[model samples]
Target: MRSLCLLFVTAAALSGCASVRTHQGYLTDPQLVASVQPGVDNRASVERALGRPTFMGQFDNNDWYYVGRELAQVAFGNPKPKEGTMLHVRFDPAGNVATAENLGLTRVVSIHPVGDKTPTLGRNRNFFEDLFGNIGQVGSVGQGGGTADNPTGGSGSN
Candidate 1:
């Protein structure tokens, strides 16, 4: 009886171990997705089957979005992706399916590139001048103190 109980407890504990989940959260079944006729599957029907979208673009109103994000909650930790799926549904002028693109992690493009500089048209200004220009007497050639000739507000101690 003792041996049997030990075996049962071990089996139970082993069965309780967490198994990583895959292919259940995002990215609907490829076969099922392929079966969906773009225009035939109305907006409400998709929502009923696939829940809410992750996001909806404003300027590009034609495209509807569905996103999944995962971040680690612990401090001093590395966050890993739990599950992410993107469904970009594009509609034509007649409200027909222009395309239903399933973009996954492989398809995602990092908008932030390394050493990427913001495009600028105007000339750059002096950094110190731009930062501390207004802190002190900027008009006095940036020199400390002022001459007696101009005493309106040279001391800067109003």
Candidate 2:
């Protein structure tokens, strides 16, 4: 009984350390993807074959993208991409397929932010300065000190 209990605990610990695999975005079918031929396949035909694209181009509507990624995560760690596919389909002005390209994980870019606070080119103020910096600087509309409305600091006789 003690050996069986130890085996159960070991199995539980191993299960916690197992990596979880996830599939995100489009599910690619190599045969169907290869069937889409440029110039021969139009927008309607491509949509009929591959359903809908993952997303269209941000700037131009003529570009279509089918993105897929297989990610894996172990324990409490962040998920990392194990495999990725990006299918790009470009259409000409006449709506005919201009180009069809397949991309892989080579284009994936990992970005790390510099820090929590962004640095700016300005005066660095303390906590008190930030709280009371604008004191006695506002409500100068009628102080007669060369305001923006009356640049000459003269009476309103014009």
The lDDT leader among the candidates is 2
- Please report how far candidate 2 places residue 120 from its true position, in Å: 6.3
User: Which regions in candidate 2 have their CA more than 4 angstroms from the true location?
Assistant: 119-158
Per-residue lDDT over 1-158 for candidate 1, one digit per residue giving the tens place of the 0 to 100 score:
99999999998876655353434335555664565468677566566656666666698766777665443333334444655667787777665557788776766565656676776775466898678655645566435445334445355567
CA lDDT scores, all candidates in order: 0.62, 0.90
Positional deviation of residue 38's Cα in model 2 after best superposition, in angstroms? 0.9
TM-score of the candidate numbered 1?
0.44
Worst 10 residues of 1 by lDDT: 69-78
Against the correct fold, how does model 2 do in TM-score? 0.74
lDDT, model 2, position 107: 80
Error of 2 at 118 (Å): 3.7
* Per-prediction TM-score: 0.44, 0.74
